[model samples]
Target chain A: MKRVAYPQMGNLGISVKSFLWELGAEPIEPSPISKRTMDLGVQNAPEFACLPLKVNLGNHLESIEKGAEYLLMAGGIGPCRFGYYGEVQREILQDLQKDAEMIVIEPNIFSIYWSFNYLHGGFVSPLRLYRILKFAMKKMKAIDDLERITQYLRPRAKKPQQVNLRYQKYLKLLDQAASEDRIKELKAEGIERLQELNNPEVKDVVHVGIVGEIYQVLEPYVSLNIEEKLGEMGVQVHRELFLSHWVMDHILKRVDRSSYINAATPYLGAMIGGHGQETVGQAVLYAREGLDGVIQLAPFTCMPEIVAESILPVVSEREQIPILSLFFDEHSGEAGVQTRIEAFVDLIKRRSERSVLA
Target chain B: MRGYLGIDVGSVSTNIVFTNEQMEVLDSLYIRTQGRPIDAVQRGMAQMYDKDGDLQILGVGTTGSGRHLIGAMVGADCIKNEITAHAVAASHLNPEVRTVLEIGGQDSKIILLRQGIVVDFAMNTVCAAGTGSFLDQQASRLGIPIEKFGELALQSQNPVRIAGRCSVFAESDMIHKQQMGHNTSDIIAGLCAALVRNYLNNVGKGKNIQEPVTFQGGVAANVGIRQAFEDALKVQVIVPEHYNVMGAIGCALLAREEVHNGEKSSKFKGFEMLDMEFQASSFECDGCPNHCEVINFKQNGKLIARWGARCPRWEVG
Candidate 1:
């Protein structure tokens, strides 16, 4: 197995590509998740599978057809059914007799290093491999930092489209940036450009926080670009979920989340896997920050999200902050999603206006 | 004569309602969209214009799947979703109403309200097995008029069991029941019961449905489905007089509030807009792999509105 491919999620694919290259294997680009890919996934997957699994299956098949020899996927271990996805996908692929080797890497602090030692296997020096890993992390960090700027400026930019343009440009620039200084300089320049386009502050702007499953929160395709929609509707959206952040928090365990744990205790006593606790924690944090509303997006039948959904009403009622829970699947309609979002925005706007009068 | 105007364009029907400042209904009309929303909107507005002359519109609102498209066409002040619209209309009709069971042409939704505010809501878009279109298709297939479907269903003492998880499954099951010598009325009632079951399991799943539930939408016009709902919940389901056009009524109420809140002049372009020549055109933009089908609207050959593009490249200035 020479060339490896993984399912694309936001800009994580680029980072993974760099990782595979350093591992002495070429990385084939998984095709972008589109209607065709989703259709292919749905055709091969079980009818009731969640959206991400179907997309991942489609990505694997697309890469295999493109001559990818190895498939690198992550493993989940929790109450969430995502833990069984890898085994199920491998079984499905084996049943089809696809000409590819599947490798499921458990994403953990030690497992990541172990996977590194296993995939490399004396091809590259340990020192060089460590350097490659560090550079990839820097690349991911750059991507997340630039996205944070977009989330801040998109709602305030005089030409909102310009912020999107700059954000896209930064994605490409980050890919080419080899050294840490170049990435930092690019990040600084990107923030400066977005700041220049931002319009004067408008008071009483509805502030919303987005929290839910990681992919649904980060992948614009799944959530239907909800952050952008909220931005265009004159609502400032705060999203704390990022792929790079996940790496540091979940794998490295470096980021301090005592605040999240403390806030989630009243609603969720413990983590129920699949970011369920984090979702509730984030909602509470948003409420404390005086956000007007919070929107939770998840795939249909997501176990962890289902738990979060059940507990969100209590958080909403007690915190006096409104929450809108949106679930999507292959059959989810964009128009329906848009209608609910627009109504939710209007509801918050009206509620805030009434409060202001009182 | 200062009234608000509301428009609701769904997959199967286009409805418009006119309401006075107090949110009381004045005139309303329901027309089949027939796969062309623009023509339906224009025709409905033209009929409204022909009936009520010298009626000044204070504000306009649009709802349903095509809210944005029609809101732009009608110069609407507030464009809301069917959930909020249904909740508003239901609450207006029954102040203590806590649940709204809306089954439209191709979609169904369960909205939970508390203290006249929308507390939670769920919509079933992918599954059309329990929607108005499903009933319409089955009615046509069984050689029964849709208007009489409910009346026939009410006559059945023993409703046969039909799978209502998906439209295809339900159709096949209906055929099997028919092949087994099931009466037409029993089969119809069975389908109605199945739809109610599917709805409660899917759209209303995990939703705390409280009493004083108001069932509205095109499907609510069917007395059989209404009774099935009553039997399922064991609570009398109230079907408002304007159940079929509640979305439009809610939109009008929203428009009235929007206009009153800002205390600004109405943005309505006036009835003269109906006389203007407006055209809509769509084209696929191959700038990327997505090839989004961007839509644009022109009035008298001037591009006035454009959307549906993922990037700025396909945007019409």
Candidate 2:
């Protein structure tokens, strides 16, 4: 079988893809998210569906039709719509009468044994899979490190072109290293290169925290590259949610109450019981850490974030922090976001000025 | 001599409540928004100013859907969500109260309180079967005024079951019972019962609804609905004194607290805000595919505030 694996972005997809590759399985390259993919997704998806669900479903469907037999994804159980997505996607594929096996790595609060067994069944030796995973994780960490380092340098780049060029070069190097045996060496070199590019001599700038849903947080096309736009405007960016943190918080830290409860006190109660709790905890931490402002981005129909958005005012009032909640659908625009960010930054600057006067 | 002004402009109605330095309700007005929040707010402000010309508005707190726009127009000291404003009002009135069942003109919300802190709450927005709008529509269709519908329901000897799963279902079911020759009182009481049942199933789902349960909002005035709720839940449903204007009262109380605590002078525009010309328009952001709807407010030909924006990209002048 000729295996053509798609480029994996985060922890879940990377883990699954690496495991499949280790088993001598062929994985077709998933299509890049484009207008055609989004249009197909919106047309097929249920009305009022969240953006992430539609996009991911569209990507999976496109890949499946391109002769990929195994379509892999994750599943959850909750009041949030995420828990039901896997089943809904399965039904949609079935309705389309696709022959691909929808491999769902079910995320349960209790065990990873089922996930391990499923992967092991495909592999001849579990130890070989373990070795592959070990290498994959190191590569993942390196990629994460390189991205974080770039965030620091990107804002201080004298011109927009400089930042864009540096980021593009680093991203290409990281992607090439993902499936290679010399992943560690490539990652280390990339990190060192990125670190060397950023210097403390660059002009100090105001930092803003971006917190919200996974899709809007990561997708530049959706958020209008608000981070890059902000950086171009001479503002440093601090994104609160990252793949590493999400893995640690949702996967490892969630294993026991003693592990995450103290650190995430507000989230300990009833899970809050979705991303609402997560968003609130992050907002509070962002404020307490003395970030200038926080921009919470979410889809328009999202329930958990809406609940968080409602209570965020009280948090803002108490902490004397300014948080802006931005909801995105297909209609969200760049100019609108720019206008709001400018106002927020202006507010922060003026507030600081008043404080200095006092 | 300074007074606090609290304005709650909901989708259906606009309310303005006034209080003295001591947080006493001095004057209040409730008017239907009638698809025009700007006009309703101006009219409400005009009435308040006319009623109390000499009152110096030291502070203003605005709440509800149009709070952001109205607050900016009036130079409000605080702009809060209806949930926070309502909770504050409920807590101030009866600090010991545990739950708030607020059924307004268009929506119904159940707020669960644990020692004055809101622990859990649910709002019924998708379905309007149990909201006051559904009830009003049914009453009007039956050729009975909403005010008398509750009274007519109270006279029913035996209540029938009206399917209140959805407003359309409830209306059809009500008509079916009426065609079967059920008395008007029975049909009206049946609606009251059906709405209570629907609310309990949806909004009160998985909730340990304890007392003292305070029912406030426009719908609280309906005695039949209260009786139906009481009979269904087997608990006493307490209605606050100012049921129709709790949101306004809460906002006023919040304003009073903000003014009393903050050292800076209030941002309130005094009574002259009643005559100010304000307009609001929204446009889609074209910078990205996200296309955020940015609502901008213009006062006297100058944009004062731009809200409903998700990102700060456009905030720069």
Candidate 3:
């Protein structure tokens, strides 16, 4: 039995672990993404690659060191450059002579044949593969649900860290859950615990919508935990990205595309790839909802987000809402970034206070 | 007798400005940071108040990367980013100012204004090629005082081409040009042009820079860069009399505005507080992957403020 490993992005660990278990492979879990991983990634990666690619590369090498042979990766097509990450990373590892096989799951709808073939070598029964996939989908939904609860409770909890602690507790509980009903029960228990954790101190807080590139928006480390920072400042953060929602709409093709496409049409007419259109859509959505402001966080030199940033000012102007665009890189100063965020929060707060009088 | 105090604690310099109710530059001090922001601020304060400390301060404002630290040290009323502070100062100094080109020691910024309100702004990211420190390094390398470097560049009849895309490349190109027997003045002139092109391409990209453009920050001391900007934009770039300390002046104006806007009293920690022990220190929190360097500020033995951490986990009341 070969062991497969993959990088952690939010709740992918639980989802992938279940699928790999059902597929008859011993899934060696990648260690939690941390400072060591980032350092290793930075040392190994090309200087200009987007932050996610570098960190993911670090995850693979660290996994390989821990005796995991084959690596599992997902690909995205078009201008994202994420599609090429798998092959590029493979070449880099090969050049290092690490002797690891990379199994890429094509991001195209229902394009699981290649990965399944690799997993079974045409020996596994179709029924078993179907069951494994179904289990993975259920786990993904469950993991994403837990995350939604965390996001909802984080800012509202008087003790902001209580939400994070409950999140960790639920994550482990869901990971150990045995059956479908058990998983549902654990989710309910998690929700109840989170409610208990929620503090009643939240009041008249500034509501901010965060929208940007998928990786920067979803991964806390990549964007430097911006949502959490805003929450600590007593701001109600309304993040526009959810792993389950993204997987369902993009991978499962279960949702209508027009819902976002129509909203983004006025500002951004074409799909510019790498969540550019989605960013514009979310910004417009939050603006219309009369949220305090919107924050667009993208990696430096991100082509799609640069385009989105260009159009965001118009959305902000039309909606009469403030917008702050923060482009992150490794060298970004923590204090400088904080100053901008504080100033932005103040700008919106002062603007609202003035409007009440007007 | 009554005035507002603004303190700008930057990476390269700490500046203090005092502005009376009439918006006049009462007294200003600019001193090198030498990597100690707290000490630099103290030195600026000492210099500013030396033998002429009779002005009654109404409010205090702080701006720059170290705004929070200095704000807490002095109990400031308003703490603002350099972008807003620069824009505020430029608009007040030149009411018709449409754009601001601020190239500080470690970074640069372009702030756009309309009808005295900041509409758009951009700051340099990880590149110091077009900043004051880089120019200062080049000046030292050519054995010219930074104050005299611009005057020497003015004498260059034919400027040599130097790559200012990156600081390393620019330095190497300068050396290569030097080895090729290019005049030092010509090389310096070329360097100024290179930086201007880089600033326009990177920091000022896609922004509509209209007249009257105000050139400020420590780099404004260099006439070569100012002329280069003027030549490129085909318009006069105005460098005000107090260009270098504009961030401080702007914060002073803002503090004055806050005072007039029905704020109760100034939070200005008296200048005599400079005699007290105020310090700042940083330590990396190994709590998680981010490894944030939390900065702690103290006045005497008691903690005044803490900053630079992403979370409030280490914060103490």
Candidate 1 lDDT tens digits, B87-164:
888988888998999999988988887777776777874677889988999999999999999999999999999998
lDDT of 2 by residue, A249-272 (tens): 676563333433343465334454
A1 in model 2: Cα distance from truth in Å? 14
* Per-model lDDT: 0.85, 0.72, 0.82
Write model 1 residue lDDT over A1-358, tens digit each, in one string: 3778888787898789877876777789998788878888899999887888888898999999999888888887777777788788899999889988888888765666676666665445667877898989988987888788788787787767778878887787877776789989988888787788778864556789999998777778877778878877778888888988888887778899898889999899898989899999999999999998999989887888989988998898789898989988887767777887887887787577667776
Q: What TM value does model 3 have?
A: 0.87
Query: On DockQ, who's better, 1 or 3?
Result: 1
lDDT string, candidate 3, A1-358, tens digits: 7778988776778878877777778788887777788788888878888877788988998999999989988787868887888888898899888988988778763567657657654566767777777777776777777777666777787777667767776888878775788888887888888888677766677888888887788777767677777777778778757777777777778878786788899989999889899888888888888888888988887889999988887887777777788888766666667767876776566566666876
Task: Give the poorly placed runs of model 1, Cα more than 4 Å off.
Answer: A21-25, A64-67, A78-99, A108-123, A255-271, B52-55, B93-96, B156-191, B234-236, B258-277, B288-291, B313-316
Residue pairs with backbone overlap in model 3: none
Best by lDDT: 1
Q: Give residue A335's error in model 1 in angstroms.
A: 1.2
- Stretches of candidate 2 off by over 4 Å are A1-55, A58-358, B261-263, B288-290
Scored by TM against the true chain B, the candidates give 0.95, 0.96, 0.94
Question: Candidate 3, residues B1-317: lDDT per residue as tens digits?
Answer: 77788889898989988887787998888888898888888887777777576767888999998788788888888888887888889988888999999999898988877666676677776678889998888888878899998888888899999999999999999999999999899999999999999999988876779999999999999898888898899998999999999999989888888777325688787877878998777899987655777878778878878876655587767
